[model samples]
Target: MVRGKIEIKKIENRTSRQITFSKRRNGLFKKAHELSVLCDAQVAAIVFSQSGRLYEFSSSEMEKTIERYVKFSPDYFVPGRPQVELYLLELKKEMDIMVKKIDLLEVHQRKLMGQGLGSCSLAQLQGLETQIEKSLRIIRSRKAELYADQLLKLKEKERELLDQRRRLREEEIRETLVRPMLPVTLHTGKDETGSACRMSKHSSEVETDLFIGFPATRL
Candidate 1:
């Protein structure tokens, strides 16, 4: 019968899968041997059963063939350590950090996304303006209080200085008032006693220029 195409995957039937594994493994080793003999070449083949049996054929020693496979296989083999795996790990780390940054940026963008600055109603804007004005007023009040306190201090200092100046002037006046008297000059005229009294007194004389009975030095 012309059978329909089968999907190229593992057969689920246990007996059929074992039969296929045996047939394919034998065919693969037979082809490897023929090619090695006919072309006068080195060849190696290794196969593993589903139950962990290792089958191998080689033109040279099996161990030597395995060593060559490990050194030359490009897909899964690496010498000592894998540089490609280390690079992939570093790339994964960078991608993880980039993902976290993108998440944070998304959250920030959501917070500010819909604030249409030009679409707010006039009353709402006015309220905001009023709030700002109140804040400014409070600040100005605090500044005025500081200015007033400074002015009060300056005025108190001014009053103190004025008081000190007044005290000094009073001291000067008192000292002047208690000073010794200076010599006097007089212009005499005719008195009520019908005499021209020229009043003068020497320091050694008696205090008797008896026109009005007041001493000339006292006058």
Candidate 2:
């Protein structure tokens, strides 16, 4: 008679649970061994009992199988290689590139300082001379431009001084022309009472001895 399928649930009785665990674990190991031998496939199994007993079987070395699983499985944890390792590798590549560039720069600097002339061909020497001449020309041109700017500033200052002097001289001449002249006073004679008489003279008139006599004595 075909038996009904057993309900897949935990065995409640302690003794029955232990018996079922032993039988099922041995059967699983037997099937794994047969599959490995018949199909030439690697198989591994692990069982843990309620009493904390360990049971494990492997077609090959347990460590080797676990290592292979880690290599092929996407969810396995790998030691010694993490996200930080990728960053470190990229950093090392950049450092290598920088070192190469530094070496190249040092060589170029040595060539410029005339320390390694023996390795340079005639064409390279000519090129170096041309580059130096171009750099010198550029420097001299900049220097000349600075000198011209300074000379222009000095010329502007001199012109300002000349203009200031001219303005001061013109102001002086204007003040002189606008000034008023004062009249001259002269003592002409004494009166009969002994009081001296004075006369105002025009600034343009000439003095004469005829004006020195007393007015009463004069006609």
Candidate 3:
């Protein structure tokens, strides 16, 4: 017969209860073993009966198996492991703690998640808002200070470069003032006819003006 279903509340008959507990305990352990074998699970089961006796089974090292059942990811774990979700039942018992004693996130949750303290005053909101505003102000001030320092350093560098260019130009001007200057090209001289004409252009900037000094040919 399929005898898996049974009453859940207190058993009025002590002997019947004892018998049921033994039967169920054996069945439970058998099921645990079957599950471990069938699913290739590293499983552990621990039972403490009404008589305070312990019965346990582990498919692998009991500690390792149990630890695997309580793994946590990184993000939700603010200060420690996020495995506190595993302790939900325990946390529920201590739900009535003083507001100051809880975590900031928990308080934030209560405030935002509609699960926080029953009464929040306008003054409290004002205080929290004030802190937020102050934090923003401090951040902005620090950013401005950093920006000012960077701008000052950049301006200093720019000034240094400008001064270097100015010094180079002044040195060049001084060298030009001291060095021998190249002779300049002259305009064309007139022939006996007093006409200005283009001359034989040489590779040099120095030009020569030829006069037909005194006419060499006469008719």
Candidate 4:
């Protein structure tokens, strides 16, 4: 006999809904059991009736299967104390590792600062000395490089200033040479009436002689 498909909707009658729920819930649990047996898998099913009755089935211990699910399921809310304890244990391990690393760093820092030397072995002291010497060499090399760069910059600045001063001096000399000279008048010896007379009508004809020899020789 061909059976027609039933339309899926909420049953209107309470008795009919109860009967349907009971039959479907039993079928679902049976299918879960079959799946677990056939595939050698863990399966669980939980249902609550309209009257608030709880029904559950599990391939193994119900608690163990649910705990496993919680551990593996990303969206599952873990309300169990055992899971919280496991998380605390993991957090403690990470904190212990971080604390150890911090202690090691503090010890190394103290050694570098030349403190707490009494606990260090001879080899450790020697290694620290070598590391310090290397660091000093790096620092001194960097400082020398900086000094050389500063000296080079100062020398360049001095050269620029000297060039600027020379340019200004040359410009001053050019301006002096380009300037016009003022006219100068000269008087000749007095005439027969003992009055001074001009040597020429214009200053251009006036002869101002120049002597370059010693004064005694000229006399």
| Candidates arranged by TM-score, highest first | 4, 2, 3, 1
The residue-by-residue lDDT of candidate 4 on 1-219, one tens digit each, is 999999999899999999999999999999999999999999998786765455788999876786777788767555555774565476567657666876888999999999999999999999999999999999999999999999999999999999999999999999999999998755455574434434344555655778687644432
Candidate 2 Cα errors over 4 Å, as ranges:
1-83, 182-219
Sequence-dependent TM-score of model 1 = 0.31
lDDT of each: 0.74, 0.79, 0.70, 0.82
lDDT-better candidate, 2 vs 4: 4
Q: How far is candidate 2 from the true structure (C-alpha RMSD, Å)?
A: 30.8
Give lDDT tens digits, candidate 3, residues 36-83.
Answer: 999997767787667545567888886555445555544444556545
Candidate 1: how many backbone clashes?
Answer: 0
**To one decimal, what is the Cα RMSD in angstroms of model 3 from the true structure?**
21.9
Candidate that beats the other on TM-score, 1 or 2, i.e. the better one: 2
Clashes of 2: 0
Estimate the TM-score for candidate 4: 0.48
Question: What's each prediction's TM-score?
Answer: 0.31, 0.43, 0.37, 0.48
- Evaluate residue 141 in candidate 2 and report its C-alpha lDDT on the 0 to 100 scale: 100
